[model samples]
Target: MLLTFAILLTTAVLLVSLSRRLGLGSVLGYLVGGALIGPAGLRLVTDVHDIAEFSELGVVMLLFLIGLEVRPRRLWVLRRAVFGLGSAQVAATGVAIAAILAAGGLAWPAATVLGAGLALSSTAIVLPMLAERDLLGAPAGRTAFAVLLFQDLAFVPLVAAVPLLAMGPSSHGLPTEVPWREVGLGCAVIAAILLGGRFLVRPVFRAIGGARTPEVFTALALLVVIGTATLASLAGLSTSLGAFLAGVLLSDSEYRHEIKSTIEPFEGLLLGLFFLSVGMAANLGLAVAEPGFFALALLGMIATKTLVAFLLARLAGQPDASALRVALSLCQGSEFSFVLFAAAVGVGALDQEAADRATLVIALSMAATPLLFAASERLVIPRLGRERPRVFDRIEDDGAPVIICGFGRVGQIVGRVLRMRGIAFTALEKDPAQLDVVRRFGEGVYYGDPTRHDLLRAAGAERARVLVVALDDMEEVLQVVDIARRNFPNLKLVVRARNRRHAYLLMDRGVGDLVRDTFHSSLRLSELVLRDLGIPEAEAGRAVALFRDYDERRLVESHAFYTDEKQLIQSNAQAAEELTELFAADQRRLESEAAARSRVGAGD
Candidate 1:
C-alpha cells in the first residue's frame, strides 16, 4: 500500500513540476501522470474504483472553498451572469449537442443525457487555469466563473433525472416513476443543512474556538465538511453541492479565513489525486482503436460548445474579444460528466460502450484545452487586441512641455496636477473603454498605444521637456522609456515601476528617476499602523524612514544579482538581520538619552 502511495506521489510531483515548468499547467500534468502510471501503462495502480471514490472528496472541498469566497450578497451581484448568461449557454449547448446525437441515430433520452453532460465544462480545470494566468478578475474570467457556478447547481437535478430518463431498469432494477420520497428527503436534508448552518454551526465553532485548541478546531472543520457531504450523499445529492452550501453559509463568518486556511492543504492534495485518478481511468486503448472517430467527436464537441458559448456571450453584450475568451475558456467537457455517465449506465440510460467513448473524449478535450487557450493567448488575442474599436486618435502637435504616455490611474493624477498648474501636457491611453471614462470627465487623453514610435513622435516627445511612463504594463512602460531615451535624449523621464523587478529593469536602462508605484504608499500605511499601535508619531516616522533608506539601498545593491535566486535570498536575509540590529541600537540610544535628561533635570 505504501509503495503504491509512494509511486503516485512521486509521479505526481515529477510530472506536475515538469508541466508547470513547461507552462502546460498542473491539471494537465496530473492527467498525463495518471495515464502513465495507470493499468494501461505500468499496471501499478489497477484498483482505480476505490481511488476514485476517495479522490472525489477533493471536488467537494474545492466547491466548499469556492462557496466561502462567494458570499450570498456577492452571488446576488452576479445574478444576471449566473442565471441569464449561464442558463442560456447550458440550454443552447446541451440542445445543440443533443440534436446532433439524436440525428446520429441515438435515442432522444440517451442523447439528451450525453448532451447535458458534455455541455457542462470542467469547473476544476477552468478555474485553476484562469487563476494561474491572473485573469480571474477580468470580464471574461468572471463570466466563465458564473457559468461554472450555475452548472454546479444544475448538476444535481441532471443526475437525479438520469433514472427518470432510463428507458427500462434492467441492471439496477430501478422504478421508472418519479422518486418523490427521495426528492422529499433531499429537500428536507437541504433545509436541515441550511437551518443548521445558520443556527448551529457558528455556535459550535465558537465553543470549539473558546476551548483554545487549534487541532480540535481543525478536526471540527473537517467534520463539518464530511458530515454535510455524507448527509447529502445519503439523500442522493451531489456531495460537492452539500459542501458548497455549507461553505456559502459560513461565507460571512469571522472564522471563514481560518477555516479556509485549515482545509486548503487537504483540498489541494485530494484534488490532485482526483485528477490523477481520472488520468488513470482513461481508456486509451479504445481511443487508439478508433482514432478517426475519436478525433472527429472531440473536435465536433469542442467546436460546437465554443460556438454556442461565444454567441451567447456576444448576445449578453460582452465585447468580441471578451466573448471569444469566455468561449475558449469553457469549451471542454466537465469532470461531473464521468459521474453522470456512470449513473446513466447503472440505470440503463446509456450503454457501457457509449460511456467509455464519451469519457475518453471528455478527458482528451480537457487535455486539449490548455493548448487551445495558449493558442488564443499567443495567436488570437494579439490580433484582436482590446477589440480595436476605433482607429488611434490623431495627435495635434501643440508642443506641450509634458507628454504622459499612459492616462491610467497614475498618469491621470500627473495630468490632473499639471492641469491645475495650467501646464500643457499630452496624455495617451490605449484602452478605449478607459479613454471613454476619462473623456466623460472632460480629460484630454488620446486613445493610442504609447509604444508606437510614430505615436510618440506625434505626441511631440522630441519637443516635450518631460516624458512620464505611467502605463500599467511594464513592457509598455519600458518601451516608452527606451523610445524617450533614444529618440528624445533631452526629455526628462518620470517612469512608474510596477514592482521590484520592473524597477530593476528601469534602473538597468539608466533611468534613476523612476518610482516603485506602491513603495511610498506602503511605507506611509505602515507608519500610520505603527502610530495606531501606540508608537509615538516621531518614532514611527523615524522607523519608516530608516527602513525606507535601508530598503532603497538594498534594492540598488540586489539589482546586480536579482536574477540569481540564492544570492537574492542571502542578500534579503542579511538586510533583514542588519535592519533588526539597527532598530535595536536606535532604541537603546533613545533610552540612554532619556536617562541622561532625567539625571540633568534632577541635578538642576
Candidate 2:
C-alpha cells in the first residue's frame, strides 16, 4: 500500500511539472499520466476503479470553489449572452445533432438526449484556461463563459430528464411514469440542504474554526461536503448536482477560502486518479477493432459542432471575430457528455453498445482538446482577424508630456483637471477587461502594462515631464516608481498612497511627490471651513500649503523607521501627529512675530 501511494505521488508531481514546462495545461498531463499508468500501458494503477472513486474528491472541491464565485450580480451582468447566446448555442446544436441522429435511425428521445449531451462543453476545462491566459471577461471570453455557464446550469435538467424521458407512453401518469414524488422529494431535499448551509453548516464551521486547528477545520469542512453529497445521492439526484449545491451553500461562509485551500490538494490528487481510471477503462481492444468508426465520430463531432457554434453565435448578434472564438471554444464534446450518457444508459435510455459508443466519442474528443485549443491561436485567430473589430480603437499617446498609470476614481479626477486645461497626456492600464469597458466609455486610454519598460517608452516615458503612479497594486506601484526613477529620472513622479504606511514606503523608494490618503481631501477642506469661517482666504491657503509640506517631510522621515513593526506604526501615526502639532505651533509663532514686525514698521 505504501509503495502504491508513493508511485502515484511521484508520477503525479513529475507529470504535472513536465506538462507546465512544455506550456501544456496540467489537466492534459493528468489525463496523459493516467493513460501511461493504467492497464492499457504499464498497468501500474492496478486498482483503477478504487483510485478513480477517491479522485472524485477533485471534482467535488472544484465545483465547490466554482460555486463560491457564482455571484448573482455577475450572472445578471451577462444576462444577454447567458440567455441569448448560450441558449441559442445549446438549442441549435441539440436540434442539428438530433436531426442527424434521427436520420441515422435512432429514436427521437434518444437522439434528442444525445444531441443535448454532446452540445455541452466543459466549463471546468475551458473557463480556467481562458482566465489563466487573462482572457476571461474579454469580448470573446465573456461569450465563452456565458455559453459554459448555460451548460453547467443545464446539467440539473439533463440529469432529471434522462429518467423522465425514458418513461414510455403507457405509463404517462405524472406520479407513476414521471416520478413526481421522487422529483418533489428531491427538490425538498435540495431546499433543506440550502437552508442548512445558511443556518446550520456556517455556524458549525465557525465554532470549529474558533479552535484554530487547521486540521479540525479541514476535516469538518470535508465532512459537510461528503455528508451533503451523500444525502443528495440518496434523494435520487446526481452526486455531481449535490456536489455543486454543496459548493453554493458554503459560498457565503467567511471560511470559504479555508475550505477551498483545504480541499485543493485532495481534489488535485483525486482528479489525477480519475483521469488514470479513464485510461484503464479505455478498452484498447475495442478501439483497435473500430478505429475507423472512432476517427469518423471524432471528425463529425468537432466539425458539425464547430459549424453549429459559429452559426448560432452569429445569429445571436456576436461579431464575426467573437463568433469564431466561441465556435472553436465549444467545438469539442465535453466530459459531462460521458456522465450524462452514462445516466441515460443506466436509466435505459440507451443499450450497452450505445453507451460504449458514446463513451468512445467523448474520450476521443477529450484527447483532441489540447491540440485544438493550442492550434487555435494560429489556425483559428488569423482567419477570424481578417475582419475588422466592431469596437472603436483606443487613442494613441501622440507624444504627450504626462502619462497616468491608472484611471480609477483618483486618477480620473486628476486626468479631468489636466484635460480641462488642454494638457497633452496619455493613460496606461493593465486590465484587458477594464480597458474594453473604458474604451467604450470614451476615456481613450492606452492598453498596456505600465511596469514593462517598452510600454513605458511607447507612452513617451523618456521625454515625458511628469508621470503619475495611481495604480492599485502596491507591489506593481513600487516597481513602476523604481523603474521610472531609473529610466526617466528627469521626469517628476506623483503617486497615490493607500495610507501613511504606503506613503513612507513610496517616499523611501525615492518618490518625492505623493498624495497620501488623498481621498480624504474633501473632508479636510470641510474641516477648514468649519474651524474659521471669518479667517482670511490667504491664511487658509497658507494653512493648507503647510499641511501638505509637513506631510511630505513626515513621509520622508518615516522611511527609515519601517523595518521595526512597532516603530513603523509609531512613525506613521504618532510621529505624523506630533509633527503636525509642532508645525501648527511654529506657524502661530511665526505669524505673531510678523504681526509685531508690521506694528513696528507702522510706528516708524
TM-scores, all candidates, are 0.65, 0.66
Q: Per-candidate RMSD vs. true structure?
A: 17.2, 11.4
Error of 2 at 100 (Å): 1.0
Q: What does candidate 1 score on TM?
A: 0.65
Q: Candidate 1, after superposition: displacement of residue 104 in Å?
A: 0.8
State the local distance difference test value for candidate 2. 0.74
lDDT of 2 at 543: 67
Q: Go through the candidates in order and give each one's C-alpha lDDT.
A: 0.89, 0.74
Candidate 2 residues 239-333, lDDT tens each?
A: 55666777777764556656866777776566666655565666666678988988887788888888988887888777887777778778767
